[model samples]
Target chain A: MTDEKDFLSGYDPGDFPAFAVTADVVLLTMRAGRLCVLLIERGGPPFKGMWAFPGGFVKLDENLDQAASRELQEETGISGIDLTQFASYGDPDRDPRMRVVTVSYLAVVPDLPSPQASTDAAKARFWPVDDVEGTLAFDHDRILGDALSHLRTVVEYSPLAASFCEREFTVADLRRVYESIWGVDLDPSNFQRKVLGIDDFLVPTDRQSSSSAGGGRPARLYRLGKVSELRPPILPPD
Target chain B: MTDEKDFLSGYDPGDFPAFAVTADVVLLTMRAGRLCVLLIERGGPPFKGMWAFPGGFVKLDENLDQAASRELQEETGISGIDLTQFASYGDPDRDPRMRVVTVSYLAVVPDLPSPQASTDAAKARFWPVDDVEGTLAFDHDRILGDALSHLRTVVEYSPLAASFCEREFTVADLRRVYESIWGVDLDPSNFQRKVLGIDDFLVPTDRQSSSSAGGGRPARLYRLGKVSELRPPILPPD
Candidate 1:
């Protein structure tokens, strides 16, 4: 074994079959009070013409996070968003042609205009998360499920829920993000007390949105606070 | 861009460099009231002669979980244990020799004898997790930290805490598992009530431990119950 290890130290790339590693971005944003995911229409085979997460093969010089961000920029003309590497999918059959291991990332951004398709995709669009009724290309269906579970679990303990909102948002706006993702309606009074009571979860801002939705008293706006940790985390439904 | 996608589809494996993917096991067990991790002394180069997590290169046909479990069984001669895939580490430089991505898993088992070394490892032994004081080989230090955090968090909301015990265990025994992992002292009265009050968390075994450690009354033995989900999970210390 010692000799084998020593011999392998100088192992060359030609020794084993090369595998392509890529990063797929599940860029999520809130649109019309519903959670939306950014997806692309493939322009080439194997799964050409099918909807998939925006991504591409990783460059040899970049790390996983960098690759994910780069893919987002290259494929969607989107940039400067904070992307988190969530998990890696490596089922042998996940890819058809050869072995491809995809490191999936979750990117949260403020609501924005439709993305301009670039690179290998024919079209880029944000699909309401609730509307993912059709089968996704590749093993993306499972990847999306894992991302949603991670988001649901982390939202309770981390201040990540605010990432989907604009710089200034009302308490109702923030509540909708949680309700939309968890697929449950929360008691408005309890939800309000919980968010505001958490001393550092939100920072009050002296801003207000124009009375747009309907005739009601203008609501105060708040921005995401600097704190990253949430105390006594708000657990999701069982 | 469409043409570029077409070019990529025709791209051969020979075009890109091949990289190896591996799985490492953070196999954990409770022994003599202390949390212990399975470690193997490397018999190969790179970090030859140092202790590290039990792992190996993944087989082409096996899934990530299968590879991890196979590695555990090969290294420790243990099988049929429940192992959970937690995270994947893929820093290009994580392994100095090549670009290696390692999927890590965490497993809990009842107390077992010192593992016999097998396969690539020269020696297999269980070390008290607290005693792993220095840096480990191949980015294992970071992997260990992530696994421990997952364990601490999962124990609260899942029935996994009892995986460290035999089919029947006393309340004191279960409390010891919590203390070993959290490194905290808990009030026996409160802990007992909390565990018992959570319906389906545990069930009476119609049995009793041969003796009690604190001395006074005989301790009742119980087995894990059917409930898979935990409500109002036991939160760790602030």
Candidate 2:
């Protein structure tokens, strides 16, 4: 082994180029029977006025997750939400001003309230996943595409789809979450059979949803189950 | 919307601190019915002579995946293997030299030859996963734990376990891969039933392994099947 002194002789911390690190989040939710993503209109350079995921540079004092949460709160007024670190983007030319590497995070909210943009963003709004226009700021289009794919994959094996629903929801509500995200129509009975067959997928409550003025039968309400992963995973229709 | 010039006036590229990015690979393989991880002895400062994953700084020219593959080849003399980017670690104090954020990759090989250390690594060898001593350099211990958990989870849902076996293997060979990684003994009949039950889990070939001198029947050889994911995923025994 080389001695510390010998190693130090050849090593210089300043020799290598340093990179700027940023945390960007792709926040998604289900609203009005469709999947929506929170996008901010860039108020600053590089891609001014263009839509982008709310994000910012990582501070020296905070860790990556903390940076993600802080940026989400500072820019969009959304706080205390769970974020999953999905992927890191570091193309040499990703940022024009400098060499920047962005760590991307994914957040699934249960119908979050509207967001008010501040701190470098001119506007913030939830755009239906299909309604997202042209290109997003930076390489965010790629990042958002990856995040959506990650969500679709995890929803099959894990009970993550429940995160998009209210505390207590009917089986149809859960089915819609799948349908909207997968962009496919599913048979009601087949969906219900597959959902209920998975053990620990739902905890049924005695109370049922109130019948609408049309006078149809009420659907039973259920809470998210104990297990994080679903057995006999609810695969999307082919 | 803010004008590009006005946004540029307020933003300075040098205002935020820069970070050094690194790519570390956790290479795992099954040998002699034991789960082993590839480790290299560090030749330089902070943790000189300590065992660590083969890694180094990410170059300015390459993408994250390319950097990971390059680093693995440079330090350990292993190349052309598939790597999965599992997680990134960026605790402010992870590296003592400077603020370094490491993107970790996991590679599962099928009984490869021994590795020869080069560049900054003094020695390279496979260490049984359970036999890793003390603390590894930097936050590698936590990184390894996360990688192991990722492996365990994916083994249930994906055909990832097959990556640890030879191209042509028997049902017992595949089962041993699980038992070794999960560190549990499984009932042979039950294991065979579950594995065969999963559609597209294995493709049977027209050949079988030669019978042992102990006079046992030759087991049929099979290759990995068409599907990437398993339906009704093989759950680990309780």
- Candidate that scores best on lDDT: 2
- Which pairs in model 1 have colliding backbones? A18-B18
Please provide, for model 2 over B15-110, each residue's C-alpha lDDT reduced to its tens digit, 9 standing for 90 to 100. Answer: 667888888899999989888888876766778877788777777888899989987776666788888898888889987777888889999988
Clashing pairs in 2: none
Q: Give the per-residue lDDT of model 1 (tens digit) for A32-145.
A: 888888887766677887778977777666777887877777777788888887788888888778787778889888788545533344467888876773567888888888
lDDT of model 1 at residue A191?
Answer: 90
Worst 10 residues of 2 chain B by lDDT: B1-10
Question: What is model 2's C-alpha RMSD?
Answer: 3.6
Model 2 docking grade: acceptable
Candidate 2 local Cα displacement, residue B35, angstroms: 0.8
Report the Cα lDDT for candidate 1. 0.78
lDDT of 1 at A95: 78
Q: B136 in model 2: Cα distance from truth in Å? A: 1.8
